[model samples]
Target: MGRELLRIEHLHKEFEGKTVLDDLSLTLREGEVAVIVGPSGCGKSTLLRCVNALEPVQGGSIFLDGEEIHADPRKLPQLRQKVGMVFQSYELFPHKSILDNITLAPRMVQKRGREDAEAEALALLERVGLADRAKDYPRQLSGGQKQRVAIVRSLIMHPALMLFDEVTAALDPEMVREVLDVLLDLAKQGRTMLIVTHEMQFARAVADRILFLDDGGIVEEGRPLDFFDHPKTERAQRFLNTFTFETVKE
Candidate 1:
């Protein structure tokens, strides 16, 4: 029930004349984990990118902490720092060691001293259970480990909000949980997150609110349990039916 940390009104985005987002609107509050779920090409990732201003929207406003991000280049870097993002590809710097990958941003962007940045990075690496692998290159770590490192990299900036763009999508079944576990831990600590994911159990378990998108518009949204189990819209019900199968076996 805190003040809204993020507010999007009448959002729209198009790519080469094809509509990707259509009058989409959403809001998020401090410490809220809002998960956006939809089939491929449904603009889930685009929505996340727009929130952080990684992509420009043709229409509407994205308000981060009551400041507009879209259409304003001056605020881009600051907005990005306030809103950290973890992509599915991990996007780690291959040439840098894990420690460098984590520390580089805080040092370069935030301009913290090298010693301070390295200390923060080491602490984050240990928090993510990757302290022992700090010296390793991206290629040396498994997919899950790399994503974990990416998470730590984002954390070093101390973002007010985190956007996860399918961080576990590239991992094998056994590897997905490790990344998810870290995300869950962050959620437990009340880190605000906006996740674009295909992981239904995760959406159900962690999201404070759920948004279901299709054909460039939000078809439905509500509390995760109601949205997943008793969707009010027929489209949402059908979408959930397809995604909610394969019960997680213990």
Candidate 2:
């Protein structure tokens, strides 16, 4: 663990007056991977959106590397540069090439030179094993490939923290492993990541700590082995029982 890279305090969120998250608080260290897991509608995705400042919080604060995150239009562009997010849907532009999709933000938002941005983009693509797909369009790629590209797009920005929100949820069973493998590789490289996932086996393999959310707050948290083998809370136990837990080979 390194310095605290992300901190959420007394976080609260609501949708149409219904509370989604209530008084949720957590901190993520610079090189730690914390996996959030729970049953559906547990506010797992909402929490990630709050941390990224994509959703408005009714109360509480989120600090990224000591700077508070707000939806202030003037500051959000820069703030987002430090926090890269990958969604369940691969939000790549259908018309642009993979390299273009990856390099677009760096070129336009960060104002880097084309050569510099493309060079870095190519390097990141190679890292994700998509070097050949640089010229390919999103529509040409499989769900898994597009998702990997999405991951590469985020990585090229060199974010201090990475957020994954059910990134494999939209993929077929056969496609899920390829995307998960890329994430496992990233975890091995010591990336600070907050992941919302239902893949129990993958969560167990990659998480340094597991946060079990329920009823709009963290119900239980522990190391992977401890959380999986011996859940302290009945909520967590019931949640685990819903999944046929299996060992995921690293």
Candidate 3:
């Protein structure tokens, strides 16, 4: 399946006395979209954080594009560049214009020339359907637009993989779909994505496979239809049963 682009082996994490993740292991194919789902505080977010090295892993290894990023400080920048992250809150800089937000990383980290970076940045804005709003500040845009801008900002770096931590969690019901549409498009484009989300329908519609996490480890994983249609574990079944007509995207 195109050489595992990401592999986690015996991963563990602890916060104070709480065990957030325990020997969690999983692998992602180069172009697969793997969705991580579970109840709150189940270590879904912790797992994602550890992969990006945003949080340290006390044990185990995380191989991203064949390099271990678990304990090596030397590979931090390179690993981070390869793994782009989108948080629940759209963390765009308030004062920076949309264009500035998208170009900030490429210009600073990648050191692309101003004109060169801006050219790419503008195209990304267009790609996210925000080309006309390039001059607007974060505060001047709606929640959906801001999130789109945030996605474009990350895409500007041309990351090999993307980590989405409930990217639409803070948005209103109506705003959630817009962001999901963009993410779905990204999936269709064959971007390797590791997403921690509650959007069951979105998962059903776009995910190639689903990983269910509980307590601290991966409880189950399979194709969306197999995982959801007939969940093997009681934990997964109970988890799925909790959703109502509103859908859990938000």
Candidate 3 to native Cα RMSD, angstroms? 3.2
Candidate 1's residue-wise lDDT over 1-250, tens digit each?
Answer: 5778999999999999899999988889999999999889999998988888778789989899999897669878877899899999999999999888988888899889999999888888888888899888999999999999999999989999999999999999999999999999999999999999999998899899998899999998899989877889988878778854676897
TM-score between model 2 and native: 0.96
Give per-model TM-scores.
0.95, 0.96, 0.96
Count steric clashes of candidate 3: 0
Candidate rank order under lDDT: 2, 3, 1
Q: Which tens-of-lDDT digit does each residue in 73-112 have in candidate 2?
A: 5888889999999999989999899999999999898899
- The clash count for each model shown is 0, 0, 0
Model 3 weakest lDDT span, ten residues long: 241-250
lDDT of 2 at 224: 99
Which candidate ranks first by lDDT, i.e. highest? 2
Residue pairs with backbone overlap in model 2: none
The lDDT of each candidate is 0.90, 0.93, 0.90
Candidate 1 collision pairs: none
Q: Tell how far residue 123 is off in model 1, in angstroms.
A: 1.2
